[model samples]
Target: MVPDDVVTYPTHWEADVVLRDGGTAHLRPILASDAEALQAFHVGQSERSTYFRFFAPLERLPDRDLAHFTQVDHQDRVALIAVAGEEGHEKIIAVGRYDRSGPGEAEVAFNVADDHHGRGLGSVLLEHLAAAARERGIRRFNAEVLPNNAAMIGVFREAGYVVRQHLDDGILAVSFDLDPTERSLAVMADREQ
Candidate 1:
């Protein structure tokens, strides 16, 4: 059994991120209490956005999915949520997570609110998620994105990891080594400029 102190919840992995559009959001580990917010976030997504993330027509988040997504161990499975708005009316705008699939490797996924698209939130979330995965000794991140999800594909391509991609059927399987290559580093450096 894990100790009570093993997972400290939001405080242990919280940060403030500035978007490229000059807006800000609070980034923190997801909590069990976030079920309602997550549900609302799902409900607010456009049909195409939902399809890109879940690969199906999911109208609502099931109870089991809620429990599984919100209550993470933060070691083998880590999820970070991006929240915006005021204290009393905050909402979850984006989510990025990685689930360990093998030794030194994990499958990563991300979803950004429709209104928050094109603001660089996805890129920021991917960067943080990669860092968190590396902290847990993960050496690679993998994802199976739809062929039409160009925005997500772009984010992964722009990331500073050595990406390997394969196309089979209608899915694009993507993998990246955590160790940054020189080109990836230069891309990141340019982003900061």
Candidate 2:
């Protein structure tokens, strides 16, 4: 377990999760060395997936953006990635992150590889991220998801949180409290079983 006093890294957050498909994936806090895997994950995503994630047709992840994404303080800014495969061959299949935007709120986002969609990566990441955020005293999460991205929306809407959302222009503004309520914990427990 990572001591609360350690502000630099939180390796205790790493966990092994079982996906909906009965397969397994490793979830861990983002590391500086993950830049290459993150880049490859970005490059491998379909055009539609990329558009949904970045809201633009970004063909490449710029160096600055890559650096910013890989580096996190594990408190106000946190990112977790899901990976599968062997040690050296492990590949990042999904990425989820939350950036604090207010005194008790943070902007959350996620990107799951197209080929690995529907395997429960988004929901698992959300649970872990919420736990991490709560430990840091964050109480709320806000997300801006493209309205047409039903996959991502379902992950949040069905997460058992009291979700409030509105469509502005074409983007969906989503917000929910991070505290795990009875229903939320039940849903997570069911998924775990």
Return the TM-score for each candidate structure: 0.92, 0.95
Per-residue lDDT tens digits of candidate 2, residues 51-157?
Answer: 99999999989999998998888889999999999978999999999999989999999999998999999999999999999998899999999988999999997
User: What clash pairs does model 2 have?
Assistant: none
Top lDDT model: 2
Which pairs clash (backbone N, Cα, C closer than 3 Å) in model 1? none
* Model 1 TM-score relative to the real fold: 0.92
Compared with the true structure, all predictions reach lDDT values of 0.88, 0.92
Clash count (model 1, backbone only): 0
Candidate 2 structure lDDT:
0.92
Each candidate: RMSD: 2.9, 2.5
